[model samples]
Target: MAQKRSIFEEVGTNEVSKPAPQGGLIEKGRKGARKGIRAWLVVIFALVMTMIAVGGLTRLTDSGLSITEWKPVTGAVPPMNEAAWVAEFEKYQQIPEYVLQNEGMSLSEFKSIYWWEWGHRQLGRVIGLVWALGYAGFALARKVPTGWHKRLLFIGVLGGLQGAIGWWMVSSGLVGERLDVASYRLATHLGLAFVILGFIAWYVFLLGRSEAELLQARRNKDAKLFSMSTGMLHFAFLQILLGALVAGIDAGRGYTDWPLMGGQVLPPDPFYIEPLWRNFFENPALVQFIHRVAGYLLFAFGVVTWLKGRKSANKATAGAFNLMGALLFFQVVLGIVTVLHGAPLALGLAHQLGAVALFVAISRARFLSQFPKSQSVREGL
Candidate 1:
């Protein structure tokens, strides 16, 4: 027999021995700590940005080949004394970069470049360690959101691949007659870096909001704006790769004039390298010329994209595109200044950082388009 409710109790509800309420978090609450994961990703993002800057410095200073070996673990401990320094310097001398380019360089001079390359490699190690530890800890604690374990793990895998790619890029310069890494390889390495950065950045954005919020926002997405912003992101990445080619062969330093490469509509002797196809990578003028043309076209497309993006019914989406447009315009000016100044250390690094900034901006705009916030009628108006 069950206990029955009184007539007075019937006014509020029927209580015929109803079940007790469930305790603990429901399924939604069990989704894990999104905010904590987002903060960790932000830290990685900053480190990678710093890595790019250090890499640019290494290239500008011609210090990339100073290490001459890829000892992933042992190399972390740099030269400890004079004898070890001499031994390392001796190894560097064997490479064409030192033999043909820096012959008779003093130990002190070698040490300078060695430190830069060493620091770059060390930073890479730190990034890997951070990612590994973060993922492992989160995973072991069962705090990673369901369905996201693989995504977070995929980033670590890419980081490992990046290490291999970094070694591949460095190895090219250690061979016969090559004063630097293969231009294509350098571009590949940098292209992958941006790819990794893109993943991390997108994840950060996604994590900034709750899963429910993102799902609801997705319903309000501006499909056209998303498509346009995706295109813009790809174009910016292409420009970044082109910039890498220019850096690989020091092409930026070769043509110090902007708008016109040395006062010509086109860079002189664009086909100086034989085999026709070889000119695209080995020819300084051709690489820089292509890079310059690409920048102008990217800017033009960005303008068209911006005009469309600013009309979004969602203010947040519009603001993202607006921010992207501003960065795009400023980046163009920065490139010209970088070229006019012969791609010196400070300007060269600044230009690369500018690219990173612009890349993030475009990414943010794309994210907003895909997950636009809903607005009230008054705000929409």
Candidate 2:
């Protein structure tokens, strides 16, 4: 015989379950929102890289000063008709670069350079818009990871600052007898661009892994290797600024010979120009010589750093360093070719692209040294 249940006892009702674990994460590997944010960052990274290459081309083509004005809001709309084109051309003609260097250039020619500068500026606007929209969407939806809002916001701030710096650079060449922007200002603008790129890259790398994974991996970071790569990163940045100086003064195109300038280890009258200090920025021979020496030293230091990176226990970290070594060598070769060809438009752009690649590689190596990816037996022997 079966026992009868009480009327108050509901069928299939169970006793109280134990409380869930407290003071612990409920989700470890689920970070879809963060991953989406990283994907958006990758898009911005590609845009900024394209902007860099475009800016290089604009400089190589002698088109940087065509706009003669910076209209952050209204400049988005380029010349729409012939009268508008003439108005823009007349504005360019008033600048020293046109009056002294490009005098008698037709409206058509002016239009060509104008488009380049306009395109460059337009790209910047596009990047800013993309960032603003993406950040707003993520923030409003509460998708951004904790502590990331400021970092993301900082990029936008730097980007706006870069726009201001760009105008300041152009303004340097617009007046007086100067035909180009000051080398130091140019270097600042470029250096800031690289800094922004580095930050985005590092953030992207960090976001690639789950927060839990990063916390776990931080325990095994190789301090020495990280330091070495950090040094390499700074050295590489210095080299980039030097390269900008060389380009600013057309030094690369002047000295076509390797291991020598004008058939001597040092060019004649290294300080033939006035002020003595002008030779550092204005003297083609000295600037080229300094750039070459820096390149050599950078290569040597890179080899030492790569060797140290090889000793890292993590395969991914070692592989990143290896790529960095290969890129450094390739960039050196591209640089030599660029010099031999007297910095032709194509080769000059190629060399600049090479520098971009090397910078990203070194950054990646440095990042891996700090937050290495662990490999499992399933991944390799």
Candidate 3:
């Protein structure tokens, strides 16, 4: 029989050809995985924002003290039985807030606050799980880029530290004669949450850039934008700390009017009981007034930044600029409404959410401003 022609020869080809499309498919797969990772990071950031908002609610509703103990593991599982509920309630009764502020509160009344605290804790658990699973998958699968690994790892560490700080803040209340957490500690805890958020926003901004473009941008526009952005971020953070102080002192309860406190430009004798130094943190009127002043300053800064961004040709900068302006306006409105409503649950939560939105917007603007015009936008005009 004639020699059987090989398949390559039969097909009129001199050499066996490797499949070219396979390489393309692999490249495409890699790209897809990268996009997925970035998208997931955005999701994680959103969850963190949610956690912060809920935490604010936990504070505003006076529910943070509802759970006297910080049993991180056991706290995950809420009361399953009637006896368990009573045990939880009994523990709360020992706290000064329950004894003094809620003397006549019933089990059902207690459960109402309990659920808010429970939900807040549960959200934290979910965030932890999501971060762990997503991070592990990214690491093992080699999906995250080499540059982001260190920074992302840092963020993860911060996330863990935030949890510890949260517990530390709670622990303060359990020991002191005071029924509530200290304003300073509360500020630190909430401030760290914003820090985590700012880091994520910065990382996302970096990921959005191509390596070559980022390198060029680093030499040109990064410094100015970075400085301004950093300033805004710091200012925003301080504003949050002030707000936390206001909440810690229950200052919102005292000042229900806007543009003035109790029908006056400033409330009378804001620091009547204590040394002048203590007024900033201890006096309800002073604390609230300080938060209000911070709001005005934040609004002014946001507007100025947005205007500067408008003068630039970069779309990212412009978007960030507009975002900050819009968020600031809404936040200011929300703040006034919250005060007018006696800080109702819904409006208070809205105010907190507005603050987070403003932070994200300001962060993005800062990130974009740091990039060169060409890197932020396609070159050619």
Ranking of candidates on lDDT, top first: 1, 2, 3
All models, RMSD in angstroms: 2.5, 3.8, 5.6
Per-model TM-score versus the true fold:
0.94, 0.93, 0.86
Q: What is the lDDT of every predicted structure here?
A: 0.91, 0.90, 0.80
Candidate 1 residue-wise lDDT, 211-268, digit = tens: 7778889988888999999999999999999999999999998988767887898888
Query: How accurate locally is residue 361 in candidate 3, as Cα lDDT from 0 to 100?
Result: 85
Q: Model 2, 381: alpha-carbon shift in Å?
A: 7.3
Q: What ranges in model 1 sit over 4 Å off? A: 1-30
Put down candidate 2 lDDT per residue, 244-339, tens digits, no spaces. Answer: 998887889998888788899878888988999999988888998999999999999999999888767688998999999999999999999899
Worst 10 residues of 1 by lDDT: 7-16
lDDT of 3 by residue, 18-55 (tens): 86754345334433345666777798899999998889
Please give the lDDT score for candidate 3: 0.80
lDDT measured at residue 263 in model 1 versus the true structure, 0 to 100: 89
TM-score of 2: 0.93
Model 2, which residues run further than 4 Å from truth? 1-32, 377-381
